[model samples]
Target: MTSNDLGDFLRAHRARLRPGDVGLASYGRRRVAGLRREEVAVLAGMNTDYYARLEQGREHSPSPQILDAISGALRMDREARDHLYRLAETLPDGHRTQPRETVSPMLSQLLDGYTNTPAFVLNPALDLLAANGLADALFSPFGKAENLARMTFLDPAGRSFYAQWHRAAEAVVSSLRQATGCEPHYPRLHQLVSVLTESSEEFAMLWSSHTVYGKTHAAKELIHPEVGTLSLTYQSFDVRGAPGQQVVIYHAEPGSPSSQALSLLGSLNATRRRESTPER
Candidate 1:
C-alpha cells in the first residue's frame, strides 16, 4: 500500500537467503541473522554506504545500471527487476500512485459467452478479473478463495489437485514476478507477493530465477478428483485496449473424452444449482 512496499519486498528476499548463499564465509561467532548488509552490497557491486542508503529510504532514483546490479545480487526474477525500477522512481519524499487498471466489460462478456470453453481474464498481477461459468467451475475453488498465486503455493489440497503441481507452482510465482515490474504501485498485489515470498520457498525460488513469460496457447493436463485426467487446449487473447490485461480460454479437444467430461461436469453443476433453489 505504501510507496515502500517494494522496499519490504527487497528486504524479504534478503531475509530468505543465508550468508553462505552469496559466497559469504562466516565464523562460528556470527550472531546476526541472514546475509549482512555489506555482503549484499558486495554482491550488488555497490558501495556499502549506498546500498544501506537505498535500503533505509535515504536515497531514491537509482540508475538502471545500479538496479540491474542489485537485481543480480538479489537473484530477482523478471517481475522483481521491473519492481526494482519502479521502486527506484521516486521523489525525495516518496509518493508514487500508479493508475488503477480495469477489465473491459465487452471482454468480460466475451469470456462469459465462451461457455463451451473454460475462459478467464487476468491483469498483470495474475488477478482473476473475469471468468466464464465453466472456467469458474474448473478453477472455482481457486477463484473462490480469491488469489490464484496463493491457491497454487499455499493451499495444501490445491497442490494435490494439480498432478504436475511443482511446475505449475513455479509458473504462477514466476508470472507474478513479471507482474511486479509492470505495476509496482499495486497495493493488493504488493501485499500478496510480500506474503508469499516470505512464506513459500517454491515462490521464493521461482521469484529469484528472473524468468518471464507472456500468455500463450498451451495444452494442460489436469487430474480432477471426480473426473480423473483431462487434456485441454488453453489460448489467450489480449484485451483490445487494456495493455496488461488478457482473456485466457481453455477448451477440451473436439470429440475428445476430455470434452465429454467437461460437459458432464457442467451438467452436474447446473443440477446442483437447480436443486439448491426453492421449489418456486
Candidate 2:
C-alpha cells in the first residue's frame, strides 16, 4: 500500500460532505468541494497543521481518540469509520486479523434448509462459495454464479437479470471498498478489484468514489427467465465461525405475487434436478 492511501481516502470522504452536513455554517462561495481542511480540523478538535499533515501523509500514526474524532467530524457510518481506522493503522486490538473464508458444512446445511428462500454464502471478495437450490435457480440466468461482482458486471445476463442494475452495481462496489479496507493484504481481493476495474467502466468509476459500505439487509428486484420478476428482501448475516463468510437469504412478502413466483421457481428447480438424476 502507498503511504498516501490514508490521505487519499480521507480526502475523498471529506470531499463527499459539506459544512451544512455536520451542522456547520457555510460562508461565502467555497473554492473546493465539501468541508475545508480547517473546518474538519476545528470539528475534529485538532490543529489545522496536524490534520493537514495527516492528510498529506506526513503524520504516520494517529491515536484512537484522534481517529474517532476525525470519523465523527466526517459523519462516517460504522463501516466507513472502520475503514478510516484501518487506513490509519489504528484498528483496535484483536480487530486486525484476516477473515476465514471457509464455509462450514453446518452452514451449507443451513442454506439447504431454506428450501423456498434463495440463500447463498459469499466471501469478502464476493465469491459465491455455497448456495441453496433456490439461489442456484434464481441466478441460473448468469453464465457463472460464482462471484456476485463478476455476475453483476461481467456476466452477459447481469444487466437484464437485475431490475435495478445501477443500484446493484453501486452496492457491490461500495461493499468491495469496505472489504478492501478490512483485508488490505488479501491477494484475491486485490485481483478481483483489478479485474473489475479493467473490465467495466462503471465499476471503475464507482471504485474511484472510495465509498465504503457493507451489505446487511436490503430489498431487491430480480428478473428470472422462468419465473418473471420477483421482489425480494435479502438479509446478510456474518457466519459465526467463519469470519469473512456471509450468508445472504432472500425472501418475498408472504402471499405476494413474488412469493408465488419464488415457490414456482423452487418447484421447477426441484423437478429439473429430479429429472436429471438417473433411475437406478
Candidate 3:
C-alpha cells in the first residue's frame, strides 16, 4: 500500500501473460517472459511511453477509458478490471473509505434464524465477526476459527477440512487481494496479510500473483471431524448498512446425503448445547 502500488500491480499482472496468450504474434525468442510494454501499449491503443510511465509510477491519473483499454489488453476479469480502476484512483468519490468491520445486532439475529444452516458474518479482512450455532459446529475442528485466511493457511486441520485445499487457498487469497484493492491503507488488513505471507509459503506465492476476486457464491466440500464430507454451496451477502461486513450462509441440496449429514450435525450440536447447559 504505497504510492507505487498501482505500478506494482500492473507489473505483476503484466508478467503473468505471454504474447500468444493475447493473440499477439511472436517473432524471435524474447529475453523476458511475459508480454512486453510495447505490446501492451499496442493492444491498448496508447503510446509506449505513456504505458511505461503508468507502470513506472510517473503517471498518476488515468482516465476510465484508458483503464478499460488496459483491462481488455491484460484479459482481466471483472474483479481484476475493477481492481485496476481502483488502483488508478479512477473510481468515483466516497469509495475510498475503510469498510466497517463491526456486525450489527440485526445481522447477528438474522444469522441465528438459520437454525439448520451454517451461517457466519465476515469482515473485509475475512475475520469471523459473528456466527450461529451450526456455523460454530461446522468450524469446530479448526480450534481457532477467528479468521478464514488464518485458519486456511496456518491451521493443520485446514488442509484436511477443505476437500479442495488449493482451491480454497486461492479463493481466500484472491478475496483478500480484492479487499486490499478497496482499502489499501487499512492497517489491520495489512497486518493480517503480513502475518500470513511470512507464515505460509503458499500464501506468499498466491499473494504475489496479484489476483483479485469478490466472493458471491461458490460450491465447497468440507470434511467434518464427526460427519465426514459435506458438499455444500454458500452465498455471500453484503450487509446493508455496513460496507465491509458480509453474511455467508451454507446449505446443501435437499434430501441429499450432504443435507442429511448437515441435519445430523445440527442435532449433535443441539444435544451438546443442552448437555453443557445447567438446570435452572
Candidate 4:
C-alpha cells in the first residue's frame, strides 16, 4: 500500500479520538472532528508544516524523536506506537523493511538435540517452521497443523492445551491485528486472516475488534498429556536482520518435577516415531 494508506489510518484514528481522550476539552460545535493538526502540532511542539506533511502523505521519513512526539500527541499506547513505526517504514522512501531469512541449519539441528524439551521456530505470523519431537507431541492440539495462530484460535484441542487459552488466544489474534494495521495490504497476511475468519467463529469475532498489541515477555502453562502440567518459560529472541523470524526457546525450571516429566515425554516421542518410521 502507498504512504497514503498509512496517512489515512492515522487520520482516521485522529478523527475518532475525542479531544477529551487526550486531555483536551470538547468544545461545542465544530466542523471537523477530533483534534486538529494544529492542536497536535502544539501538543507535540512540532511545526504545523512538518506534521501536516506527515499527515498528508507528503513526508516519508522522520526521526525517532519525531515519532515519539507524534505518538505522544495521539495518546498512542505501546501497540499503537508500534503500528505507527511499521507504517512509517512502509513509506515509499528508502526506509528498509526488515528481512525474513531462513533459520540456520545448525539451529534446527540443535533444537532436535534438545530431544527432551519442546522447541520450535515461528515466523511473525505464527507459522510453525521446524519443531522438535516433543514439541510436535505437545502440539497434538493442532492435530498435525502447520499454522500456530489457527491451531490456537480455531481448534478444540488447541483450546484445552493452554490453561488460560482465552487469554493466549487474545494475544495471538491481537498480534495479528497489529500486523495487519502495520501492513494492511500484505497479500499473504490478508490470506492468513481470511482463512482463519472463514474457518473459525472465534477468530472472526476478535478480528472485528481492531485491537493491536506488541509482544513483550510472556509465560505459558500447557497441559501435555504425557507430562501433566508443563509450566514453561519462553524467551523470544530476535534473529538479527531476520525481520519476522524469532528464535523462541522454552525451558522448564531445573530440578522441578516438570523437567522430569518432559524427559518422559521426549522418550515416548522418540519411541513412537521410531516405531512408525520402520513400519512406514
Question: How much lDDT does candidate 4 score?
Answer: 0.76
Quantify all predictions' global Cα lDDT against the true fold. Answer: 0.73, 0.90, 0.90, 0.76
* Residue 263, candidate 1: C-alpha displacement in angstroms: 1.0
Give the range where candidate 1 is weakest over 10 consecutive residues by summed lDDT: 90-99
**Alpha-carbon runs more than 4 Å astray in model 3:** 1-95
In model 1, where do residues sit more than 4 Å from their true spots?
A: 1-104, 141-145
User: Model 1's lDDT to the true fold?
Assistant: 0.73
Which ranges in model 4 have alpha carbons more than 4 Å from their true place?
1-102, 182-185
Model 3 RMSD in angstroms: 15.3
lDDT of 2 by residue, 36-140 (tens): 999999999999999999999999899988988898899888778878887887874434446676778898899999998999999899999999999999999
Estimated TM-score for each candidate: 0.61, 0.67, 0.67, 0.62
Per-model clash counts, in order, read 4, 0, 0, 1
The candidate, 1 or 4, that scores higher on TM-score is 4
By summed lDDT, which 10 consecutive residues of candidate 2 come out lowest? 92-101
lDDT of 1 by residue, 88-185 (tens): 77321122334236767787787777767788877766778777777666775553545678778887757766778887776787677777766666
Cα error of candidate 1 at position 271, Å: 1.1
